[model samples]
Target: MGSCENQEFECKKQKPLLIEGPIIVGAGPSGLAVAACLKNNGVPSVILERNDCLASLWQQRAYDRLKLHLPKQFCELPLFGFPENFPKYPTKHQFISYVESYANHFSIKPIFNQVVEKAEFFQSIGLWRVKTQDFEYFSRWLIVATGENAEPMRPEIAGIEKFDGTVVHTSRYKSGSDFGNQRVLVVGCGNSGMEVSLDLCRHNASPYMVVRNTVHVLPREVFGFSTFGIAMALLKWVPLRLVDKFLLLAANFTLGNTDRLGLKRPKTGPIELKNATGKTPVLDVGALSQIRSGKIKVMNGVREITKSGAKFIDGQEKEFDSIILATGYKSNVPVWLKGSDFFTEDGLPKTPFPNSWKGEKGLYTVGFTRRGLLGTASDSLKIARDIADQWRTIKDTKNICNSQIALQM
Candidate 1:
């Protein structure tokens, strides 16, 4: 047996499983917020995290130019605000600091380095049997706070594996200083790709942006205010179609067509609105100006990776020193839970709440969807409150049952 398995076996023989009120499976912003809410409602919960510290993804995966896409006012946790001196759009470090403060304020002591491997609902016992590498714990409720960014989505392009060059995903990306003199190819046109491309250009790296599809790029700030604030205001007063039209007009006026890059304008709208909420602002950060100035080159999607360079679908071949994949991530739920077929076909949890799940009985999930702005934190609070209420009802019913039995005796 493995070391962890042997340890678990030894522990099980000496000590039985400890039944906690609820076991939260992550210690991210969502999990920490949920734990705080449960504590407020007098419900005890144990948060288990795979990382050694809270907000590891924020501290590690993000690039240096990363800042809160949402304004600080909206991104703050429940009962907490960004430091008064911090900018309206806090940097990555500032955001991580705020998360640290939130955890400290709530006195949330999550078990770090404890990865929850499996969680199965025992119908007969009416408890969730959670297993990790260290030990097993039984809880009446299970909250799967595993966020959507669990699995990094790396595309399988032809000859990618044989490229014989450096390949890194957004998760592995750290800074732009390392790409000083190399010809870098950044794949994907999302925020990360856009931001990284701009930063690399400023650092004197010959960066080429590979756009597979069209995207709506917006300014980080609008009329001296955050773009998100402006979008929210417009969304409240205007219809979605009108908003789309206005945005399209603005984008066309500001960015024009993709013809400059030897590509055609997409028939569909530039932006993707998955939720009913306002638009998620896309920061320009001088990317367009750089492209216009020839500082950074824009190319079509990659058809294949040649031995010495990459081949575009347009029959053009360009040599590159490195390729950075800004591809997205996938949800990685535990394996022991065999009933995950109920989740979205893409492996994402299906919650009663638009982005939140209607966890079975005592079970709940927080921060599964990439809702706009502070949506994850907001969803976490609601789920925590619901779980607290359910726990109370369950306790009350159990007490009443015991009382009836005692009277019969």
Candidate 2:
């Protein structure tokens, strides 16, 4: 234990780990966006991720055929545009690569495998205590960027326990080749359900889509331009109602007799549906064509799971070899937080639906409330600006206290 020999011993010993500045949980696009925004504003942040890599949800969970519903321009992160050679609608693999590149470009090195178990705010210290399984981290600001898609929500289907067929969530579904030639019932007529049904049809599987309500399915590209792009442009110049009417005309002109083809247009317009309920209409890629071609069939909502198959609300029963639930996801924030004041009983933020980013008690969330990449980008910028403003006040107060102490001495 000589002093010179002790140097090697000290080098091997574990040192106390600490992180200052802001602590961002979850390294998905939302988290990455917040971290990038903070860095650009001269504030540093440490990202803690439960998974092995950044953007694990996109890299691991998305289907092979997934593409951005919105155009690339609207989906890219703030200040970092998509690659020049990429298409208008980037594929799932391309989007994953873009996320990876975005993190690398921003020099965001997230601490992997540290799943945040609890977050507590201490008023005495004016800091947030974030505890993982193995360590404790304290931060002046806690940004929970673990967006809405972190947890998959499965609806309770009656008699599903007795069904002998394969059942899986859309998150676990990769390709349809593995489910070849099987009759697949895709529950829910959202984008994922529509796309999965189409995938199953292409792979020789008999695909049946459950459209429970009037669905607003718009063509992905109309008149050689993205319908989303056109809608966004129209939104700037016109009211939402007028924009929706224009979109309805465009849909009727492009898709042609969607009502006759089993797709009855919703009573409400697409923009209204999205704004009122955050549930946007599905942007039809090729599912509509497949449905019109008789390659894909439509069914009503599931009434019960019979021994033979599922019974729809219309008393129609059909046997399927497999059931795929594309029911969507819930945010994981309310689980990690201790109290119920911040969130509702359904785990949604009590504070408006989409403005959960403006959190209280030193807790902020980025992507939990919003719907798309553009929403994530917008949330991240606002959160960063708010955090920066608060930090400036803290610094100013500290400086004033120090000056008074020096004068007294």
- For each candidate, the alpha-carbon lDDT, in order, equals 0.73, 0.82
Q: lDDT per residue, candidate 1, 173-245, as tens digits?
A: 8888888888999998777887888888878898888888655675666556765566567878987667666
Which residues of candidate 1, in runs, are more than 4 Å off?
1-16, 253-272, 276-281, 334-336, 351-355, 397-409
Best by TM-score: 2
lDDT of 2 by residue, 73-178 (tens): 9898987989999998899899989999998898888878778888888789776877777567777778878877888989999998888889999989999997
- Candidate 2, run of 10 with poorest lDDT: 1-10
- Candidate 2 regions exceeding 4 Å error are 1-18, 353-355, 396-409
Tell me each candidate's TM-score. 0.88, 0.91
Best by lDDT: 2
Provide the clashing-pair count of each candidate structure: 3, 0
